[model samples]
Target: MQGVPEEWTEEDGGTGERSRGTGTGKGEETMMMELTRLVQKTVKESSWWERRGIDCSILAAAFISLPPAFLLLGSSHFLWFSAGVLLMGVAHGIITIKGTHLASHGALSESQAWAKFWAVFFIEICGSFSALAGVKGHIKMHHAHTNVIGLGDSSVWKVPFLSRSIYLFIAPLAVPVITPLVALGRKYFPVERDNRTVAMVTLGLYSQYWLLINVSGFTSPLSALLCMLVCRAMFSVPYIHVNIFQHIGLPMFSPTRRPKRIYQMTHGVLNLPRNPLLDWMFGHSLINCHVEHHLFPFLSDNMCLKVKPVVSKYLTEKQLPYQEDGYLSRLQLFFNRYQELMVFAPPITELVGVQ
Candidate 1:
């Protein structure tokens, strides 16, 4: 109730009575239009550093970490091996989460050819997911229907049969393994067949296996496989949790009765406070500036962070919602209320009357 609108109540099915004083009238619409213009202007005026310079640096760092990681993993010493595996996992997470995310959104490049190339390289080669599927699922569906029930609501992550403990702690360890299998399954199952998705998914998985055996000096296939599993699961818990924490449990909307873009994004999306590791690994767009990213999906992570203050202030001054919650608090919320948040269909936030 702390963050809920004054008129909202569960008894009313989240459709609070319309009040002209609550800033959901024509004045609110005008303000939202102005806010959009302001954000667009901010994006256009963003410096090269905000556009792609920082992303390039992050990508470079992720790539640079790899050789050393392989070297360390290949070492005969146990401590050396452990350290190398840790570095390898961190590098992989950064590349997949940050690099792939940006590339998927076409935020990393202005050139169409380069964007496609990066998408293949980051999502397929590094992330071990199909670039085509990633785009179709994330960009086309998720972004277009954020918080809309049964579509972009991140409901796929929910597993009702599993206990909360296992869902939270154990199940996520399988994501790296499950990701490729799902991609391969998609290829055969054929919603829309693309030879490239299967090809790249296979190539990516095989490449990593080859690297583990050759460059990482694993003596046996079993050893190499073990190393792969361990490294991939390093950040798996938070990797899965972050996806759900930011979107699920927030106000959901009926697809047919969704609010205006500004209201939907502002009310439904929650931003976690920035963490140094998460910021670097997941990118600002996924971590701290999620609301801004949802509002303008094309902006780079650096640009999202740059525009956060302006976005937050504008929403605040206009008395619109600007949701921000701490990471640990969200985690606890999910852990404590997993059944309500993860297992059930969240009640629709009825904004039709208000809007």
Candidate 2:
């Protein structure tokens, strides 16, 4: 495969290579280089505190809030218990979406050992998914080959036979129940497995159940189980929606025609409207800062947001695609054109003309 630029081939850094280009030639390279310089400048200007503080606060929130929420579940008042469940659900979502995501990318800590430790903790223990599997499926596959069929495609959620209503509405509610089963099944496949990750995940999940039953004062095992399911469901719906929304309707590519980094990400990824709630819970990589995240996958979410203006402006000035759509607009597109957008294979575009 040809390099994006001679100096910065994916093979040189193990970042993964683009298999093809859009044929825009030197002009494309010039635009990409300018964007790269801007990103480097932004990185240098960023403070150490800015780089690390948001992640620390997010981690603290996930750890500190869960125990109190669990204790509140023991309250006799219905309102109190309900409040506890809501808080617990929100905290767990942050752990899964933001905390585990950062750790999986090794963005949470500089040390590989510490990064792996927290990745396992947040993903397996709190998120009820396999850390090793996530690193393989998400980081290795999805990020390396975004929107490429049989690789980065988000086809897990695609169900062709289901009626649009059921597929869009009712199916998302089951994501919480389905995610762990999928994770477990992936473990049995020929993919890489970490014995420590499996053991830790097993222990963490069971311990959580035990705490919910005994310490949380749940009246019965069934009640504890129900609480767990409900809390996970709160995150699952939006999680499923966001995963599909960001890339499903965008341009896809055959592996042979995968464009260079900037072209591939800008063409394939999208940014949704700003939502303060999701920004905090899901982090910038998965929200309005998505394009920036793709361009700088290793940057922490805080840094991604900080550099967004430079990235966005450069893309716009160059007249390259910088896709953004409202959350509802995406939903409407998904509903109205479910077949073309989700069920059927996405159409791949070749950039044929240039300045």
Candidate 3:
């Protein structure tokens, strides 16, 4: 709510979604039309990056595997291995953030068939996620419906009194443990195919990984489990944090309502500032760039980054909202104030302007 802009209001007629309010003045405010053209132009120029083959770079996995590979040596080096464990965490997280997202959108789909195979392998085998399942859940269900109650994938909405604090922050840390249950919940309770596949693949990956670690004659069973627990926990924490900030703390409309494309995107999705480290590692998947990814999903990570400025500028000139923040600051805010940010009703008044 803090980063929420005044120019944004919810349209209440059909499908309610947070939208931008047009000001009467001309000058800078008139740039919305120009901004839209720039966005279109930049995206058109970003085609080359999408065709490039980064996903096929198998060496990325081998290189990233180094830290985790060292831990499989089975030596009395827990202290040193601890650092490796964390690196493993960072490595795996980056792979998931970059690999799965790009692949899901078909941005890395140069080889089509091979790309799908590899992307599914990375998420299922490396990231311990089900490729096919999560893709649909995200691209189809979530992207199509941002912050729209049970429809949107925005993880920010929370239960009654707890707000987003406990649900978004603390609960997300438990995701490594909980997602399996989430998957299980879907399986038995009559959920979607993708949801069930996500669970099964998760179980399969971890089971195979543990067997492989054991076969290597690595540390005792206890140590191996500890390493895994830490690895999964570390990965889940940052990912969940990133997800919660993406589309929460905005507006949510009903089943039949919808917001203007730009306003819905501007208010539903947030930028979350820029971190050079994360930018280099995860690139366009990090912030409001994600919405653009959702929009022009065929663009590669590099191309997405290139077009990000154009999109951000489009939102700003339209007097639209674009939320961003330092990671540490947001983490602290999650612990302290995030809960209050969740679960707000649509604005009583409606705003104008639609195509």
Ranking by TM-score: 2, 1, 3
Candidate 2: pairs in clash = none
> Of the candidates shown, which would achieve the greatest lDDT relative to the real structure?
1
**Model 1 — TM-score against the truth?**
0.89
Candidate 1 displacement at residue 163 in angstroms: 0.4
Q: Is candidate 1 or candidate 2 better by TM-score?
A: 2
For residues 114-195, could you state the per-residue lDDT of candidate 2 as single tens digits?
A: 7777777878877768876777677667777788887888876788999888887788778777767776666443444545
What lDDT score belongs to each candidate, Candidate 1 first?
0.80, 0.77, 0.55
Instruction: Name the 10 consecutive residues with the lowest summed lDDT in model 3.
Output: 1-10
lDDT of 2: 0.77
Clashes of each: 0, 0, 5
What local lDDT does model 2 show for residue 215?
80
Per-residue C-alpha lDDT of model 1 across residues 77-156, encoded as one tens digit per residue: 98998899889999988888898888887777777667778888888877888777787678656777788888889987
How good is model 3 by TM-score? 0.72
Model 1: residue 92 alpha-carbon error in angstroms: 0.1
